[model samples]
Target: MKLAPLHAAKAAIESMSGDQVLHTVDGHAFIPMDDVWVVATPSGPASFNFNNLPGASPELRQQIKDVCRALLVSAAPSRASQALTAYRVLIRFLAEEMPGRAVEMISLRDVLRYGASLKAKELYKLRRLKEHLLLWVDLGIGGLDDDLLIRLPDLETKHHEVGAAVRTLDPETGPLTDMEYENLLSAIRNAFTEGKLTTSNYTLLMLAITLGARPLQLAMLKCGDFTVSARQDNSKIFILQVTRIKQGKGIRPRTIFRPRELAPALGTLIQQQCDEAREWAVAHDVAPEVAPIFLSDRSSINMGDIGLRGHHSGKSMAEKLRRLLKDLAVTSHRTGRKLHLFQSRIRRTLGTRAAAEGHSASVIADLLDHSWIDSSLIYVETRPAMMERIDKALALQLAPVAQAFAGTLVMRQDTDRGRIIHTATRSQLESVGTCGKHDYCRLAAPLACYTCTFFNPWLDAPHESLLDSLLQEREILANTADLRIAAVNDLTILAVADLVRKCGEMVGRATK
Candidate 1:
């Protein structure tokens, strides 16, 4: 028998009520089919004018079209026919589901229950539909409901089981252990020291890690952006000119003092790059500014038989960085073969250090260029159990505790509360070599802060930055003072001790 026309079949089902759907076109009206067939179908073309729908908006229509497109792209001819049947089913269901209910009156609970009854993956698909509805609200689809969306239960398993499974993967995503951190850093440094990377790349990596620079920020650094000056004691201070800093909000600062070690390294990198560029310029008669700090070498430049200068701009530095990382056996989150040995290692280190230094969340947010302090808080995820203990112990304060153990330590008199708690400028700890405590003094040992009797100079940085003082004040106020020491037995000492241990642990992880 000849099949009925599709439009004729649809027209026949026009009179069907809320409980009945036009399953097949057979003339001017439609015929009802098995409920199971309706359940198996998913979508269809509208029988009535789509624009005539009671509350459809431009965005809602767009969403419907998108879903239709996705379905059409994946659907077979038979599946498409079945989907048409399902659309009819949905219309019938909606009619009976909420009679006379305006679009705004539809609640999340109703939508969720309807969705939850589907298969697991289908349930997720329905959730996507709900999200589309949310977008519709933004696009002014009727007067939308203001109630909060109820979270759907995970259809696959219980919450406890899911959490346990997640915890199993935590070691990879969570902060690295000290040894792992140190190994990663060492590997990256070795790549530089062994001459695997050019001077510019080496300098960039160091600055990026040490100063917590993002990839884009590191890429934008220029030759003139840094300065190194020699001190009278034959020491050098590196002053970094971070013109394109992410946190600077596009405005360059006049100058900022970087760590003392950066000066010489930067000088070497800059001079090498400049000297090479100068030699090249003399040979080719090119301008000095033409030599970008990170320009690709002519040999590596893919010319496709064309001259290197023609396609030189296309060589991506980020891609080169990724290749360098592979050479160093580093796993990267970035797409280009960029070295990630220090990306995670350095951020975790800085985050842990800044948090331990008693820097406020806002300060960290600024340093990290986080849009919110809440985002920065994610980095301060070390030693949770210890922090809880410290919080409780701090209730007793440190004055009485310090007085009780006075003679146990050096009992140095200092007016500066910071000096009592940490090393400051013009203080004994700030000096390089005055402590005659040991041949291998704890303070002088690399990555060994626990055995040190003196307050670590690094710890005193925040205090000096705050007070703007040169000398550590000398005053003894037993009534109110918390002494700095690296002992586990004392609570006040435990705080700093915790930091030292954590720092050591971080170093250990990088090394591993």
Candidate 2:
């Protein structure tokens, strides 16, 4: 099809079923050709040979030329600006890359080959750009419904490598050794003392560590969102009302209480940074609009070089975090202890520490802004080795009681004394302070159970039942197919049963 005639191109596009064909550009339907004008580069003017060219208006074409020139100048003339240079290179490539046998056709295989040559992270980015360009083809330039025509070679292996490359690009977490943890603390303290990090970043880092917040969410934090006040008794408390989150219901803000550990450091950090920014703004005589709370000191340090004072953006804040880790030589505390510089690593560390400390999983999930509880559970899930240790400890503590009632115990006891028996059991339990009825118990005099009489019968009954229950539970547990959880439970249950039996015998003999 030699490009459809100008009037025919417009008619073909306009005639397409439904709103799918919004307009036509060149010979492509659904393209808003009139919205833009192409300034033919001398390198490849033949790219514009579509019959329905809709001829560019002189003024619009001039504007496009001006835009192209301005972009070229601003991008600088260096190897570092290759991507910017590629904007022009790509325009030229498109002329020839387009399928010669078909109008408005581009070689997806070549695009994929070109994309594959770039790094995995870069390839993902280009794919997004490709998607954007397709959108523009549909909306910006009136174009035919040719989305299905665009194709790329299969990337079966590339799909798997993409994930690995993402991890390489940014490792979210690894263990943190004691020294590294302390070093992070030290850097933060020094930054605060020297006014090197602003209060916003300090509070933000603390909040990020405490709540596992993202950079965008941190950037969006407003001063009014902080609720600093005192209780009826005048005790001070500061609450951060997180108004926006990424993972949960859209716009469903969740508030996380500031940990007591961070309360002392937070207010001072915020005020120190805010005060410094205000002072800097006044000193430089710069407009306040650009000075956000997290602006860096680099611009303040070199205010004389630029016409307008430099200010920080969200991108700069992320870069600053990378710089901090680089300066500190911070590494993931794993095998080889490889250095990590990504902001996601920082968030993960915060979450991992919280999980290790026994905070509620739901709270951790909220802090991390995880959409699923299972994702948050990963932080606290005990590994097989750790679970084995827990099993050993539980068994060791319950051994004696289980041994005493090894055979004579019953799994269920009818101690109904109408007392809501509730399946009484006397497993070797960890001491959690006096039972709720401790003060009122008539058997407070408890040196020898036989002599006291109050501690023997009831204790032995429950003790026997507990041992029997544990043994039965262990027997059932042994049938578990998985080696980790079931094995641990089996060993732990058997140990507890033995301890219960031992405790039962001890009480029975005391009574005898």
Candidate 3:
């Protein structure tokens, strides 16, 4: 940016004496001098408290705010809070060590000392500090001087080995083993079906897990975006137009959106959610316009009580996901710990799954709606080796921990529960279990039942044969295609292993 325009903006900022609302290029407004600046952003209202930077002078606050205005005007709302965070760290650094000193008093030595003081893990923080210092110099705001400018270009030339994406490398972080994702997805469905998760939340979780859409994009979803497109494969295709963010300046943000296809069931659920959002808007006396799908209902899902746009912030989505995960407390067989759930983890898992399915970086980028392929390069680089070694002992060991089999054991010699849960063996209807809670199950019989809690397996039935068949199928698929595709039924394999162990123990005890 030219210093002339920045100076003119600074001049305009300096002229504001009383409470003044500054409008961002993105159509959001905030008072620059407020104790807590509640900036209305597409994601939601982000609050940055100047009081958090204690013992800071009004002059320092004004300078920070003035410099940030250029950022707010040009960049996305998400960057605004981050810029504040970077500023706070610098000001706090000055206040602690350099007492009674203005920000301008810091020399190149002070800059070097501050840079050295930061831990390696806070490399991003150090970068942010260096960035703001440069901006301050260029914009003529007070922070650092020209002496450090010579070393600034050298910092860019420093050699460093790049690390793989943490989410892809760590099993605990996710690219969740197919089994783990299946279990969590099942758990979430159960939670929603059992009256735990509301329509808004249930739909949001589905979209996140299924599409890997960012929370910012999801938050920006309006009721109108959930529209039906042309028919494909004899089925009506539901298209969700997700608003794009961080697309860089000069590109119209929300005006340019990516259309993502939703599964029929999820599409139906989202349509239902849109209905609720409409009702909610009417109940709240909010004139029906383009409104957010996930309305702010942290208090209650009660009609007329839902908060309007920017209420259900991206933070709100993250918090909701956190609470849901905490409530479910789903344990991971891989780590024997509750899965560390995050939206980013889910997004990473989506990318990893695509990569494992032999997708290129460009394909992964399109899947992730990334403007550049560089962001998705990490997933394709790291091999998803979560399912390479799944022997019987390993399966048995993790089986109990996974709790993948939610079915009840049917030991009796009767089909009295509801219906016979049977699969084919040697061209015969071989009964394995009973669907105890059978109310016309839409799931694939026998295979899906093993993981369901409703299935009651006959104790002495051909469960071992079932296990053998699934393992054989898994091996066949792995040899021919991706291990990710082969590992789709891994949870069921664990279930069958757990069942096999139980059946053997029960049969032996009876013989004894």
Best by lDDT: 3
Tens digit per residue, CA lDDT, model 2, 209-239: 5555565455434333444577799966765
**Whole-model alpha-carbon lDDT for candidate 2:** 0.40
lDDT of candidate 3 at residue 492, scale 0 to 100: 88
The 10-residue segment of model 2 with minimum total lDDT is 40-49
Q: At residue 354, what lDDT does model 1 achieve?
A: 68
lDDT of 3 by residue, 201-319 (tens): 78778888888887767766778777976665667788889877667543544678888888889999888878877887787666544656777655222112222342356666677
Q: What value of lDDT does candidate 3 attain over all alpha carbons? A: 0.72
lDDT: worst 10-residue window of model 1: 35-44
lDDT of 1 by residue, 199-247 (tens): 7667656555666655434443434454567799988776545432323
Better of 2 and 3 by lDDT: 3
- When sorted by lDDT, best at the front, the candidate numbers are 3, 2, 1
Ranking by TM-score: 3, 2, 1
